[model samples]
Target: MSDGPTDLPAPREAPDAGPYWQAAREDRLVMQNCYGCGTYRFFPSLLCPECGSEEQVWGPCSGRGTIYSLTTVHRAPSPAFRKIVPYTVALIELEEGPRMMTNIVGEGRNEAAIGDAVEVCFEARGTDAKVPQFKLAGA
Candidate 1:
């Protein structure tokens, strides 16, 4: 099984982050795209970092990336995460040119290698929670 808490703590949403999270709930991966500069930025913001434009748009992600960096957790950040010891925290370099931290999951969870190809897959929680997580490509 992919390592991590069975039920992740509910996400805390900020005003600027609403669209991103809403897209996730719909099982869609999106990034803040700068129309002026044609660059994508993460940790969503109203203004584009590259072009200083407030006219940014949410663009769909191919849900594809490469493992830029990673760590395998043998310990938990909190007692509630203890059950997920040995989970992976990775810096995924998305095809759109932004890197974000996310967990690596799937049958190859324990065998992730740097530079491994991955595709985004949604992890549904109960009824309304759908989180985009990375799995080995084609898994």
Candidate 2:
């Protein structure tokens, strides 16, 4: 078993995510908040989904969340992920009010449970892109 997050695919940052990527590279998670509708969004969009408003600002995320649901992949649909099969991919509910799809690292596959407290950690693949991953939080 791996002791840390591994075998992650290279992150492909969105065209408008230069600042967001910069934060992640510094080991911080950043998400966009739409000022118009007061909703948080991931993957960085130009328009707010709740109210179709374009007014938005980027800020640092809390990086604390709970595992909402998870699935273990026994087979990789792509060759790039084949080596890392049987890993847990989860949808975590953030404490700051967003749900993100990310990999649950560190603990065993069965160690992850519904509502497990997790904290965000950054994984850098290169000089430009950094990915956000989750791990079991401390007491």
Candidate 3:
């Protein structure tokens, strides 16, 4: 199964996701920080869910988290994922308190477990291509 160096799907460029996408393209993980609510939000939203505030800033992430939940897809749901059968998808709880959906890569992808410590790494498929993925920390 292949989860790297392939024609992965291109991400949608929504207005609020501009900064996030730009950071990912450079192999950097970032999140929105709501100063009004003193909390962070993942997946990039224009409005803060904590206190319904729209004022925020882009903050860098440690890219370290624990696997809060996970699932292994033995059967590819779409053609883009066919080559990566048995891949692990995880809900990573970032150090900053926000959770995100992402894939586990490298050898860890095959053996990811709940509570496993992971660190973010970029998987670039081609020239000017980059996506954030994770691997078992110190594995």
Candidate 4:
């Protein structure tokens, strides 16, 4: 994870998402899988939406996905993001079937399009957290 600016707000860790954040801090991507129904989920829920099962497992992800949608931010929403105004934010559809919103970074980020393949990368947030970001596959 690169040392990002400290002006931006850091994400508050959710009680159910400690493992996920821990994995991110370790530079790994993981998803919650329902052991009862074999369904994968994101955003860390306590119960499985598919079967109402409380049993779930944290599993490593392939860290690969396709760009389901995207937009270029030509203006920063806040002063903290002013330095990176022309950045790309995309909804990535993971191979595990969950869609996660993240930034498209690295070379060719500005040219991202729907259906483009992407791979996960970690970026530093404040001092203690790492945010999962994406870049064009093999770029």
Candidate 5:
């Protein structure tokens, strides 16, 4: 019914995610780029995945991608997501080039397909709380 720790939300971002959030607040999808290896990264980390470099910078993304894979959750530990049973969560491969796992909102759960093109959208839960999500491309 649950994949991991549904009792808690995904790990909260460290203060280092500030720039990424700032870009999101402006409707921009920003990822991290390693200065040492020139690789695009996501989820905000201080080190490069390709290399062990600690120098990174924010990079803008195209907000276009295809669903690399997905899963529909039948149950949610939190009552808030109870009404959203069967919601699809996907791993998107961005055209600007990085894969980020996020929920696919505002679309029929059965509509998500592997390799289906999608676009970025933001769901703001509160005045200061927002999350990046995906939807059927051009939908």
Candidate 6:
């Protein structure tokens, strides 16, 4: 069986998020860092929220985090996800400080709890893209 849903819709690539997606395809995790203020931000904004600086860089992430919060979906929101009902979605607090929403996959996903350690993994989204997901640390 698949570790997570294979038929889920692909993520739309925003112009500023291109690097993040490309990095995912290469099996690496990255986040936007503001050069002006030395702050990291997610969702890949063009301007740094802290210092309002347009200068930014894509930096590597540790790919390690703790589950800040989570939920188990007992019902699929769409037919494509029906086959994967009962999947877990979690808000992961990355070691670098930003939190990201992603699916918790692989072993122990359903039993995942807040504060559980997790590490990044990639799930193919299509021919050219991959989505970052998480699994229990060491699982």
Predicted structure with the largest TM-score when compared to the true one:
6
Candidate 6 wrong stretches, greater than 4 Å: none
State in Å the error of residue 138, model 6: 0.6
Runs in model 3 with CA error above 4 Å? 1-4, 125-127
lDDT of 3 by residue, 1-139 (tens): 4644787666556786778878988889989999898798976887898899999999999999999999988888788788767678899998999998888887756778999999998877556656788888975
lDDT of each: 0.82, 0.80, 0.83, 0.87, 0.76, 0.88
Each candidate's root-mean-square deviation in Å? 2.0, 2.2, 1.7, 2.1, 4.9, 1.5
What lDDT does model 2 reach?
A: 0.80
User: Which candidate's lDDT is highest?
Assistant: 6
At residue 132, candidate 5 shows an lDDT of 75
Candidate 1 C-alpha lDDT tens digits along 12-120: 6677787788898888999888888889999788788888988778999898999999999887878745766778989999999999888889888778989999999
Q: For every model shown, what is its TM-score relative to the native structure?
A: 0.91, 0.86, 0.90, 0.92, 0.84, 0.94
Tell me the spans in candidate 2 whose CA falls farther than 4 Å from its real position.
Answer: 1-7, 126-128
By lDDT, the better pick of 3 and 5 is: 3
| Candidate 6 global TM-score | 0.94
In model 4, where do residues sit more than 4 Å from their true spots?
Answer: 1-7
| lDDT for each residue of candidate 6 in 27-103, tens digit (9 for 90 to 100) | 99999999999888987898988899999889999999999999888888888678778778899999988999998
RMSD of 6: 1.5
Please report the TM-score between candidate 2 and the true structure.
0.86
Clashes of each: 0, 0, 0, 0, 0, 0
lDDT of 3: 0.83
